[model samples]
Target: MRIRLQPLAASIAVAFAIPAVAQTPLRTLDEVVVEATRERDLPGAAAPTAGELERLRAATSDTASLLREQPGVSLYGAGGVSSLPVIHGLADDRLRIRLDGMDLIASCPNHMNPPLSYVDPSNLKSIKVYAGITPVSVGGDSIGGSIVAETRGPDFAQPGQGLLTKGEVGTYYRSNGDQRGINLSATVASENLSLSYSGALAKADNYKAGGEFKNFTATGRGNELARNEVGSSAYDTRNHTLGFALRGGNHLVELKLGYQDLPYQLYANQRMDMLDNEQKRANLRWLGQFDWGRAEARVYHEAVDHYMNFGMDKQLVYGTAVNGMPMYSRGRTTGVETKAEIDLADSSLLRLGALYQHYTLRDWWPPSGTGGMSPGTFENIADGSRDRAGLFGEWEKRFSPQWTTQLGLRYERVTTDAGDVHGYGNAMGNQLVDAAAFNAREHKKTDNNWDLTALARYAPSQAIDVEFGFAHKTRSPNLYERYTWSTWAMAAVMNNTVGDGNGYVGDPDLKAEKANTLSATFDWHAADRRWELKATPFYTRVTDYIDAVRLTNNAGFNVLRYTNQTARLFGLDLSGRMPLGNTALGQFAARGLVNYTNGKNLDTGDDLYNIMPLNTRLSLTHELGGWNNAVEMVAARAKNKVSDARNEVRTPGYALFNLRTSYTWRNIRVDAGVENLFDKLYYQPTGGTYTGQGTTMGINSIAPGIGVPGMGRTFYAGLNVRF
Candidate 1:
């Protein structure tokens, strides 16, 4: 398949040919929104709004991919839609993710679906990332930091206006995998009430690599001739949401409902593929403002039914006799949170909040002829449940015109348990050694977690600002890490987070992880704010860090057991932007960023698994009447230090280039881009192992030690209409 670039070029030419017209001045692209409270110099914080967000949304459909350029942020690929975000070397459950103030958890043991996957990029209005040493009031049960994604909210008509209606439609296409998508949103509003609806559909075929194949370990049979294509990397998805809101005086109420359907998705880092996925969610919120303070409350519920099995591509070589494993999982969560802010004095304010959550899960598999197992049902985790209650307080003080400080603390009580679990041997009236050993253990646990944060900011002059932060955070293990109840390879693999193509068993006696971190940020800006530079450095130490331990080699698969260890991480992030004086043709700007992180196991003296290599990005942007254009370069250092315990492989470093342009005319917008402009062949340091069927390039063909290949050169275009 080939994409014609002539038409895209013609479109750009036509946009430039239009006669110039008088228009309002456009906002400079270098301005950034500071989402943190009164103090704008908070360490390790970023909020990309307006034009920056629109440009990012046009680049990819995966929500997590949008964070790749943020300081200390990286992505761990799972499926086409499920790219997990990592902050400062920690990922998955270690980070707190909230969408529109609602906390969501992944139902799949493989983490095929995460909180960010629930919101399409087209629906997002803004995103805020809080890096290491996050504020206590903004984080809970997490150590890495927090991410908040807010969707488009209701808009009301002006007073004295009777009614208002508006809508938008958008479509995009990518040639790399023949990917295509469409989004629709509409709204109706009156003086006091509003209604809104949103819908999206997206699909893609397997993507191809930039070069020819090379056989590696675990690349599978008959895959040696895969050429440039990465098999089984496809997906189909659809989503819908409805919202309503009412306002009276200083009080407002809102409600929202959402639904998602994912019929099929392939996981290149997993042994099984997602055959079906369905989810539903509902949320309600209330906000009130009084002379002395403000109060807000929210309630939400989420549920998912997911299934996984062998794909046709894999069965062709492995066959039903050796493969054909099927599994099912169901998860439901309900929660409520309320917070209030009070005016204590002219220079001080106090914030308090309380939260409660209840969660339940079940995972199971049914015996079938394909595997030649006894006829029965095996319960991986049955009636697993977790409940949590928390309370927090925070205070912010402005000491003087040049100084500000904040302090916060939080406490949480968590309890977990599960009903008796059974394996196929029990259903077949036989005592399997693995099943008997697991069934004999207790399944109830409790934890008391606490969090603390302190930060201060000072602006010595208009051109210089300095900030410092410190935090102590705690997190308990998830249900899968405590209640998997089996030592079998198939059941154990479901509890893994690193996606290293290995099976894993859970440890019921695991302990909570506690992290202590200190970070600092320095900012320098021109008097007019046209040029700016920022740098942040951080260090963290973790007690009882969750890690994996090798168990046994069964059949052709390696199995691991979950355990706890001491760990440490340190990193630095630097960014800068500058604008050149405007010329007759247009305005120009330059921006760049560099990020690096190091992580190690304190007790074992080994490197952390899948740590990202040092990377940097630079871009030059130009703007004319109504058009914007940019050229970007991305480069990374070679990753030679690998984790021997996980059988990780080292990858050579490479550089790639990309081009993008956009134009707006009246109520219509057009965007076009070409990625991998140089067609460089490279590997993603954090793409996990190749579990897809067939043989490909790598060191270990039977189990492949090489990382997944990066996508080849591709062209993309998008159109949006709004009124």
Candidate 2:
């Protein structure tokens, strides 16, 4: 049946004008009114407001850094713009991340090009996170949480307005790393159609710590770095996006094309650095609003070509026998999703959705010289593929003014396979034996996973509310965890993902990880909502957790293989904001948050790696008209409960101070800030090991136990112009 969009549009307009508080008659507007669009989401999901984003974007280029203010969120340092976000104690592949409705995958073995790296901070229009208790609508083979980030899109003009145009230009610079960037966006729109474009360029050099942390400056490449500088930490990248949208009454059709070119992104933790990475993406979506509910369908495709080698800071030549080790990876991902919302009644709603994704990858290393690498091409993961198909349904009901509940269930069929692999290793390790063993096994494997979530909310009084939820989540292993075959120190270290300075082998017989989580949030606010306090406590127990088993120990570094075990994690988050009386200078406010998490392996009694210690941040903010200013103090407890299996490094407790201020006037805005004001030297507990410099090709070439140091005092400024 063909539906008329005009009637649907009319019905939706009437529904939008209907007030929930009263039966008021509609009035024709004489002037255009602009408002932000809100997407319907589960109760627990949260997003940063526009004002917050404006403040944070000036200080960072890494998109993952924008989530630092969110409780229970942390970041794993990587390339300059490719920091990996961690929810609670789980990081990387454990979390489901989506950009413009596309599920992107990291093509590199070391994960240098994460999904968030594709979008610049200045280009984000909306970003949200659902921690722990994720609804089936956004949940699949992920156990930690879900994140959705969308770039700015077209905004249609009024029905009678003719040809509207808008544009913005922004630039930023930082002193510590000599980092600089610029971004531009433009849009042309009519009542029924819109065309938009956005682009960004960013680059940085190696950054230095507050003081000298290393004793030598040799880079094994005939180059020398400053004693205080952290080598292999530079990057250069560019991004471009084009978007188009058409609207007819209540129906909307949107298309977006994106491209990224990264010349280089040096890494401080991995043995190899990204020399070049290119990505292309296309997304198409259709959405409609009906009197009963809403419907949406989306299709997306992505392609990536990635290359890695020894950046200038690492050993490039081995006894003049072999050239720099070169690695390459290519990947393609295609996905389709369909969803619908049905209004069962005034107080009840139901949602159903289905999605399918197919992904393929090829990782190889070509021979570079007449030495051990001259024999044949090394096939790390050849013709590897992973596919998933999922179906989910959710129901939500409002029993009364004070009580509401939601329940959701999801089912997914995941299958993975890989072609045979070969290594060019010449008597270095068990390459032939391992490859033969892997080839003899059945590469095809399948898993049927299930997810369930139940949540409820209660409001006892005007000043208090409580939300609680329970979830059972399941996750299958990524290809790197089940396919990589070699155990050679050189090849193994290239496969490490956790930044523990250890090489890891894969386990094909691994079982899917299943996590059972319980959490509750307590929110308290004043009668008028002038002040607020919020606290969340969560606990999770996991069966068949993919940890590692040590295979060889050399010095402090070790070689390990993926294994299954039992694990558990618990955490608490506390945040509050209060307003001080207005003053002549500005309106002052105080806000702060405290986060703590603990993780342990129940089977081995070892602490989980990369777990953040207890940390807190306090800020004093001031605002008056076009002026915004703030001073922040951040502190953390010592990370003493280290992971014993990988010999995790311990970092001492530290405190730092930062100052920021911004002002806007008419069409121009400026932001300036100083971080690490005192220039205190400190180590990042999760920054991984300090194998960023010298002869890092060998597994035990450098001394172990040195954690990557944090950056020194830095001044930054940003400018934006709108027309």
Candidate 3:
């Protein structure tokens, strides 16, 4: 199928370059793979499973809002500006995100940056998403997958004494039947150092309940409340990202700094109130390609500062005479990482990398008179750090023009330390614990890991190709899970209580989660057609699967524990694009993707928590001269599967509609789109749990059912100009 669409895709690429699009063309709808290893596109990647890059200068909000159309990917509704991607069953820290080859970590328990939010969509040269085993160059601690966002490189457009400048400023207002909100952004870029920055501040009155708001009373009679709380449960947010990139000769570099603050945000899925939340990050990367092969390197650091409260359905105040005051706690994290890659000959590639990070956490209170829970503010402050290093190599040999195979291997070492930390009891929630003093403990541990891959490709003819691959990968535990102490505001806790209180004590004893992956794909084209199709099926087995579970000690709150257990994830992906005729009018196209995941917890005999549900995305796009437009429909069946683990909540299913349009002219372009067009109401089919307000001083947030409810419908628009 891919064989037939290559010519049509090529022809459209040519027409898209003329007139309006020539001035500020978005990424090539169909890019070729070069260095992406698995599927390289422009600076990003060429895989169709990925979404197209809409011009950032023409974007309405943060990049996270743009990716909501992807299948199995949804936003965790804190508000418009602060949303997190629930990637196929895996969200939060499970996914590995990189910018210009550098890693960016989220600090907020609520997850502010949410991967796509790190880079101004307008500044992105391209975005490549690898939902499967992905290539070794992009692998690390990634069990669900990887997403690489790249900035525009120098000499990417035209070489030799060239000056290009582009910028945009715009605002949009949305009035759905129940609520209203507005968003805006500004961006600019150039060849020497591309700079694109965007900021959005927005608020919405409480939405009219789609159906009925349930009132859970201590009595058996649950009341059916009217949807009359207009503006009563409203929320607000502020999000921004500033990115700069320098491309010269064979050396290219990029840097991005971003922040997200969502205060007084309302969520229908949880029992608490988000009074304060913040996410801050700085990411840097450098890449150089020599005559031999190429080299890429990067470093990044970020911090999350968070505070919030729950327990009230209406206005309440407890601290400093604040109205509707509620129980509140705070926590923070500072982390850093660095990595490097070097490509050898066409047949051989080598990569070496290391990551070091530190996290200091404190969970405590400041006299909330609302309840007797504030015991003169007892606190637990602990320090945690991670040191990791690895070496990897891959070699691909082409015996013939139609046949090629590649083999890869990686070895790594990791160490962890938790110093000067204590777990609090009674005062926060645990009874066996001390409320008047800080419990202190120390520990250190190390681990060794290995990865392997084998790939084979065959081409009966130039237009048809088939590939099969198998790989083994493993990733170390994150700093938060292995050495977290105090309380997680989102989970509504006051102690590091997962794997066991031992996790907070710093279990340098933890081992890495290992995965064995197998995959097969086919790309076929007709002899004389403008069409193509691609399909892939995969299965992965994880040994010593690391997960967070409630502690058996049952002291004050649930402690987060990390342990390896056997688990499995398997699914299929299929997509195709076709052109009706050779002319510009017949150049319309259609594409779609569907994926699924099913796994078991061999240790406890339960389903994996918060796994992605079966989902699909279908899009119809058209190209006519200087004008391009598209409409996509996305849907996901709810995952009713509930884990047998205690405190686990199930999520609900949801569907959304979206539209995108763009027109290009000489040095000018305009692009606009609307997501969740219908303002539909739905929650994640998989849910998570946090402590309820006044429940205790230990935990804060939780996914209620399967998952939390996503955002209602939204619309975005923007413009771009180049000189």
Q: Who wins the TM-score comparison?
A: 2
TM-score of 3: 0.74
TM-score of each: 0.90, 0.94, 0.74
**lDDT, candidate 3, at 294:** 52
lDDT of each residue in 1-723, candidate 3, tens digit only = 011111121122110111011111111221122111123222221233112444332333445555544433444443334355545455555566666555555433333334555444444554445554455545665665556666443233244536544444434444432232333344444445566666655555554423322333121112222432222245566667776777777677777777877676643433444666676767776666666545555566666565655423432433444233233333333334343434444533344445544444443344444333343443333354555566666554555666666666767676766454432223334422421222344356677877776776666774565667777777777655555443333223322222111122223446787777777766655543346566667777778777556554432324454556787766665655565555636477676767676667777778876566677788788878777788888788866665555444545566778887777786555667766778676654542342221222223222122223444555555554444
Candidate 1 segments exceeding 4 Å error = 1-49, 216-225, 316-323, 370-372, 426-431, 553-557, 694-702
Cα displacement (angstroms), candidate 3, residue 138, comes to 1.5
**Measured by C-alpha RMSD in angstroms, how accurate is candidate 3?**
7.8
Q: Per-residue CA lDDT of candidate 1, range 281-395, in tens?
A: 9999988878877888999999999998765445433344534557899999999999887867666667799999999999888765433343567887889898889999988
Query: In model 2, where is the ten-residue run with the lowest total lDDT?
Result: 25-34
Better of 1 and 3 by lDDT: 1
- Shift of residue 584 alpha carbon in model 1, Å: 1.0
Tens-digit lDDT string for candidate 2 (326-367): 899999999999988787765777889999999999999998
lDDT of 1: 0.75
lDDT of each: 0.75, 0.82, 0.49
